[model samples]
Target chain A: MAKRGMLIVLSGPSGVGKGTVRKAIFDQGGNDFQYSISMTTRKPREGEVNGEDYYFVSKEEFEHNIETGQMLEYAKYVDNYYGTPLKYVNETLDRGKDVFLEIEVNGALQVRKRLPEGVFVFLTPPDLMKLKQRIINRGTEDMETINKRMTKAVEEIRMMQDYDFAVVNDKVENAVESIKTIIKSERFRVERVFPEYEEMLGDK
Target chain B: MAKRGMLIVLSGPSGVGKGTVRKAIFDQGGNDFQYSISMTTRKPREGEVNGEDYYFVSKEEFEHNIETGQMLEYAKYVDNYYGTPLKYVNETLDRGKDVFLEIEVNGALQVRKRLPEGVFVFLTPPDLMKLKQRIINRGTEDMETINKRMTKAVEEIRMMQDYDFAVVNDKVENAVESIKTIIKSERFRVERVFPEYEEMLGDK
Candidate 1:
């Protein structure tokens, strides 16, 4: 089998532009990486394709996967279950493609607990004010909701120490480039390389 | 004070083209990294500079620095003392310049003991046979000496697990690029960034 790929868990406070940065990374063709397809119980929205956007599944199927231990991490939100499926991630990694997951802090923490070997990268805005501005610009949340999100973002940013890497989302392109560099370096980590190549040096 | 710079320790088996890769990195202007000059008790060879090539110091001076803990790591070789100067390295780092030390396995291990936070990178040839060829092509060693060096190289390469990262010296430019990415990514480590900028979010 090819060498296993890195499980890179990217997390950040809300409105840190994780989605924008992720899209930029893909558009740049920075490296050979696979986006983890989340299994969600929510119905597919317009233009959303199954397995590309998410593995849209029935609520019962999602629960079954969780019970069978096929979910790396899962969370229930407003009667919908969303989670990272272990089957696809493991297969992609076995195929020698780094797996990328964009998750929230709590979900990232859960993945860390289960797989400490995964690289946990926390994304943050240049500052809290910038994060607030981003949320305001979205125009999807009310003033009260924005205030609540701002408070939550503060709490999440404060927990960055738990992450392996912290990147500032100052510009989408810069953030994408930073993450690409990180993944490239991570592939060369000693522990990750030793397992596959150590036996070849048996004469030593 | 400026942000503390990274301590990058580069090591590899002899004849792995470490010097070539190092020069390539510098030539490419990969990043702002300072080559650490060693303090040596050995008399300067022809055309070697005092502060640039090596800080050719008196045996007494070298011993005094070691006794005063001004030497980060020192090794006595053939009645000559060679070591990294703690004072110079600390000053460079405090000035926000990453210090790059190209040393052998023993010296790298010593530095790792004294400073666990240092980034230790081990460069390896694509394979043992390739390494032997590189050593033979140098034209400085006889058959017996070349054999001994090859054996030693195997031993050192086996200890690559002690390093934080490893790069295959397939091509000089590739190895240089690998190190550059590692250095770039390491600057974003959570432990390094959190202490410096976490407080900026206090008002949030």
Candidate 2:
């Protein structure tokens, strides 16, 4: 029997470069997993391909899929529905291919509740001071908005306690390498690989 | 306060090449952990440096250490005492240095009882058939001894349930790399790293 692939979830607070690190993972190649192409009712932006960026569908189709439980998880933003398709993810994992999901923290929270076995990684900045500095450097915002954003960032970071691993994004390269190490070592976890070895024991 | 270093314990069924894989890890360098130097009452063989090979000690001294709870775990083998000194391990970890222990499964079982936080890694042969073949290739062992050894090997493998990771020694290089990945990834485990990140949260 083929081994079920792991669900790799990458998420963190805003401005922590989760997207950049996720992009770097795929761009560097040698990855054995498939990127999640979310299904969305939102129309494609300039240069965005339908199947590449998302499985663009009409709102009616999206709502029908959600009704039928075809959507793994979904959310509506600006009157547009966006979600991961349950069928694609299940088929890929059933076929022994991993699926990678790089989503916002709120999306990850929903997925976390739904999938108990996911490898949820929380990417963090070196320290809160750096994050505060980054927020302040975006000088276009007024002081009130800046304070609000900092408060929100702190709240998001507190969510790291829910994760299985916390990786500091001190350097993109270092964070990427640490993530790769996590993926590689996770395969050797005894619970994950014990069945194969047990088979070899042969009636013992 | 310094972060406490992890204790990495590597063990496996006989002939699974635990020692070879461990040597490959340390020999390749870039390792931040100290190799376990067991204190033993056995006389050193040729070319064996006292402290480098084993911390050669008198039987009285070894017994006294054990009686005082200085020994993490100990076992008697052929009229000699072999055990890990708990004081050295604690001091090194207090200084934030990791320690690697390569031992037989019985020794691993003892350490597992003494140190719950240690990373217990079980090295496995690719399969039992390969192990039987190697046993047969030895030719000097009688059929009865061969069967007994196989049964013992099976018994040892059952202890893998106590381990956190199981690395297949399919190839020395691959096993070495996997061990390195395990070591690297362990550093990011939330429970090990959460305290520092929590401190950064301050009054939150």
Candidate 3:
């Protein structure tokens, strides 16, 4: 029997280099990884592909999916609705491909509530100052915004207890390696690997 | 503050190559690993060192430690007292070095019951046939003894649900790699790594 894939929920505060680490994993050919494309009511920015970046949909369609229970977990931020579609994750895992969900803390909590078996990993910056510096380097947000983000980052770090693993994103390559090791090792977990043992026992 | 070390309990049926895998890890410089030497009543082999191979002690001393709860876990196997001393494991972990216990299934279960936080790993051969063949290859055990061992091996594999991770000892190097990965990832566990986050947060 083929082993089923794992659902890895990756969450981090903004400016924690989650994007860069995730990209590095893909660049290094993260084996059997399928990033879950989220569905959003927000309009896609210029050069953003509809299905690639997000499943860009109208507010009516998004709300309909939420009502129909198609959304695994969804939340409204500001004026836009963002959520993970259940079908994509389920189908990917059915194909024996690991699904990576890069969502915020709140959405990750929701996923945890819904899919308790999912592996929850929280990425954190090396320190608050480094996080602040990274946000400043972006040049898109003002000082006030950066300060607010730093405070929120601390609060998020406080919620680390809810996660299964905490990864310090000091270096993108190292962080990616850690995550890959985690996933590879998780495959050996008794709960994940036990079902196939019945036939493989080879004694009967 | 430095991270506290982990207690990794490695257990396997006879002829599963547990010893080979363990030695391979050490040969590759398992820098943080400290094998927990068990106190035994049985006489050591001619070339076996006293403290290195086994802390060969008198039956009276081994029984006294068990009665005083100084032994973490003990078993009387074939009139020989074998048990892990609580002091060595505790002191080594206090020094921030991971302690590895290579014990049989029953002893591993006792450790799990005593220290629920310890990581339990079960090792098995690639198949029952291979396991029986390995037992026969020992050349010391007679046919009847080998048959009994094979039956016991099947029974032991059934108890694998009590373990956290299961490694198939198909190839010694691959088995060692799997165990190393498990320990490395277990270090990132939130419960183990969260306390350090408070100081790393930089606000406290």
Candidate 4:
């Protein structure tokens, strides 16, 4: 029988470069795994593709998924709906392909409650000063917004206690390598990878 | 204030090459960190030093340590006592040096319950066939003893669920590298290494 794939949830504070680190993982040829594309009611910005970047759907379609329990977890933000689809994740795992879901702490927690066997990893900046610098360096938000984000970052970092593994984003290369190592190491977890060992022995 | 060192406990079944992998970690200059030298009442074998391989002590001294609560956990086998010393491990951590202890699963579990913050890693053989072969290659025991050891090994492998991390011992180099990655990555855990940020923000 084919082995089951692992469900990995990645969460971190904003501006911690989770996107960059995740991109590096994919760029390093992690295409065998499925990157979960979330469904959102928000309109796509420039260069965003429907069903590729995100499953762009109307508010009605999003609500329909919610009603049918098709959406694993959903929440409204800035009057737009965003959620994970249970079908795609389960299907990918059934095919023995690992799945990666990048989401916020709250969403990750919700997904954990739904999929208790999921692997939860929290990424953190080296320090608060570096986190603030990264946020400001983006050149997108003003000082007031940056302060708000920093406040939120502190709260999110506190929630890191819930994660199974924590990776520090001191350097992009190091952080990406750590994440890859974590993926490989977790794959060897005896219970997850060899659950049928006892049954196999019993059959013998 | 200087950062506190992490107490890492490594455990695995016998003949999993955990000792070889651990020696590689030290040989690669990772021994700048502390390796806890366990105290044992067992008489030194050929070429073994009193304090280098182990803190060899008399049975009276070992019993005294157990009475005084100096020993973290101790077990008796073949009419000899073997155990970890709390003072050495705690002192090393207080000095800001990472302390690595290669112990059996029971000792690791005891330390985990007592320390609660120490890292626990379980090293596993590549597979059952390799594990049996490694035991046979040791040539220290008869076939009957080898079969008994393999049965014990299966029981120990079942307890892998209790470990925080698992590394497969397929190759010495790969196992050592994976363990090094785990240690380096764990150094970034927010709670263990970043408690000051919480203090700076006045959050517990």
Candidate 5:
């Protein structure tokens, strides 16, 4: 039988370049793994595909999945629903391909409860001052919104201790290298690699 | 203040090439750390140093250390004594240098209890057949002793699950690379690098 693929939860504070690091890891060749595409009740944005970008569905369909427990975890945001689908994640892992879920701290924690063996990685900035600069450089939010995000960032960074690994995003290449190292090391964990060995020795 | 260094325990069945991989790591210029030299009452062989190799000591001295709680763990083997010194390990760690302790599974477990943060890595041969070949290649034992060592090897391999990481010693270079990856990833643990951030976030 094929070995099971690892489930990885990637979480970080807003504007810490988590998306960029995730892109770099994929760009450096992690195509064997699946990037989980979440489902949402919100309308598809311009150029976004219904099933590829997200499994965009109506409110009724989303509520139905939630009721049937098909959703791994879901949250309502600004009158729209967003969630991870359990079916796709299970299918992807069963196919012997690892799955990456880029999620917020809360969502990652919820997933951790369901998948205890899942690897949770927290991406962090070098320091708080650098984080503030990166957030303002985006120019996507006013000072009030920026302040709120900074507050949330502090809270998220605190939750980093709950993570299995932390990659400091001072440099994108360095952060990607750290993440790659973690993935490789996790693959060598005895519980993940030696179940057959355990059984064979048990019989002896 | 300088950050604290991690304690790393390296354990494997005899002749799994743990020594060779460790030497390669040091030879490849990764010696910013210290290797913990264990103390023993066993007589020094030819060319072995008093302090540099094993801390060759008298039986009384070994027993005295055990009574005084200076040793981390002690074992009586073939009418001789051996144990790890807690002082040297703590001093090396306090100097912000990672320490590698080459030990058996039992000794590794004892150290782990004392240093709960230590990383435990179990190295293994590719298979039992290869392990027997490696032991025979050492040319230090007769057939009877070889069989005895092989039996011990199987028993040691069974305890691999207690390790945090395991590397199959199929090739020297590959095993060294795997160990390097484990060290790099371990250094990125959130608690090790981001304690202040965790405290400031008020989530601790």
Candidate 6:
């Protein structure tokens, strides 16, 4: 059997640009990690391929998956379901392919409870002040909503303690570079190399 | 006080190219880690700077340091004493500067005993068969000595379980790159970044 691969979860508070950094990492085309395709009940947008963009499914299918404990993590938005299929992730890892999941902090926490061995990376803003500035610059939320976001951001950033690594998203390029470093180093970690080395040494 | 820097120890079995990999990493000049200068009683050869090349010392002084428990780890080769200065390493780390140490397998084990927090990296040859070939090609040792060395190499390689990471030294440049990745990702590890992030989050 092939060696199981790492489950890399990139997550942080909202407005920390996790999605932008993840896109940059993929667009750079250096890594071979499989993007964890999310199963969603919402209709795919124009030109969106079913498997590439997401695993398009009916509401009944999504709910059945949830009841069967097949969803690694899921969230509902606008009366639609979005989730990661647990079986697909496990199969990919079993095939020695790393699975990359860019998710919200809450969803990441949920995955962590199920897979503590997974590498949870918390993408952080440079600072709280900077994060607040970014949110304010968006100019989309009302004052009350903005204040609530700021508080939520602080709370989520504090949850960085649960993460295996914390990469400050000061710049998209730098963040992508650091995440690459993490993945490379993780492959060399002792736990991953121990069995391989022992086998090479003729250990049963 | 600055955050204590990581103590990165590069070690492996004899003839595994630990020295070559370490030299490539520093010669590449991308890393800023200060090489932990060895305090030696051996006479400085041509062009060997007192501090840059080594901390040249008399036999009496080296012996005094050994008596005082001031040497981090040392090994006697021929008639010369070579070991890392405990004081310098601690002071540098306290000042937020990393210290890199390239030493023998036994010496690295000693350092691990004293400083369990250090990042011990085992630089492995591709396989034991390849390692045997390297030793045979060297052709310096008699058959009996060569057999002893091969046995010793296997024993030392088993010590990799004490290490934090095991990098395969298939190519010098690749090993150097992997070490660089390890250093970079280590700084982002939760144990190292927890304090920094907590302070950023207003922890006292």
DockQ each: 0.48, 0.49, 0.44, 0.30, 0.42, 0.45
User: Predicted candidate 5: interface RMSD?
Assistant: 4.4
How many pairs of residues collide in each model? 0, 0, 0, 0, 0, 0
Chain A TM-score by candidate, in order: 0.83, 0.84, 0.82, 0.83, 0.81, 0.85
Candidates' lDDT values, in order? 0.83, 0.84, 0.83, 0.78, 0.80, 0.84
Q: Which one is best on DockQ?
A: 2
What is candidate 1's CA lDDT for residue B147? 72
Candidate 1 ranges with C-alpha deviation above 4 Å: A129-154, A202-204, B129-154, B199-204
TM-score, cand. 5: 0.82
Off by over 4 Å in 4: A30-32, A125-150, A194-196, B1-4, B42-47, B127-154, B188-194
Clashing pairs in 6: none
Per residue, candidate 3 scores C-alpha lDDT tens digits across B110-197 of 8998889999999976775355456647676677867785677668668888999999887888898899999999989988877665
Candidates sorted by lDDT, best first: 6, 2, 3, 1, 5, 4
Candidate 4, residue A60: Cα displacement in angstroms equals 2.6
Please name the candidate that would achieve the greatest TM-score relative to the true structure.
Answer: 2
Q: Candidate 4, which CAPRI tier? A: acceptable
Model 4: which residue pairs collide?
A: none
**After superposing candidate 2, which stretches have Cα over 4 Å from the reference?**
A127-153, A201-204, B129-153
Q: What's the lDDT for residue A183 in model 3?
A: 90
Query: True-contact fraction for model 3?
Result: 0.69
lDDT of 1 by residue, A39-113 (tens): 899999999999898899999999999999999898998899989998888898888778999887788988999
Could you estimate the TM-score for every candidate?
A: 0.85, 0.87, 0.85, 0.80, 0.82, 0.85
iRMSD in angstroms, per model: 4.3, 3.3, 4.4, 5.0, 4.4, 4.0
Model 2 reaches what TM-score against the true structure? 0.87
Q: For residues A1-204, write the lDDT of model 2, one tens digit per residue.
A: 777888888888868899899989999999998888889998899999999878999999999998998987888888999889989888998887888988877888888888878888999776654554555476766878767757765675678888889899989999999999999898888887766556656533
On residues B42-152, what C-alpha lDDT tens digit does candidate 1 reach at each position? 999999999988999999999999889898888898999989999888899889788999886788888999879889999987765455455647676577866775676
Ranking by DockQ: 2, 1, 6, 3, 5, 4
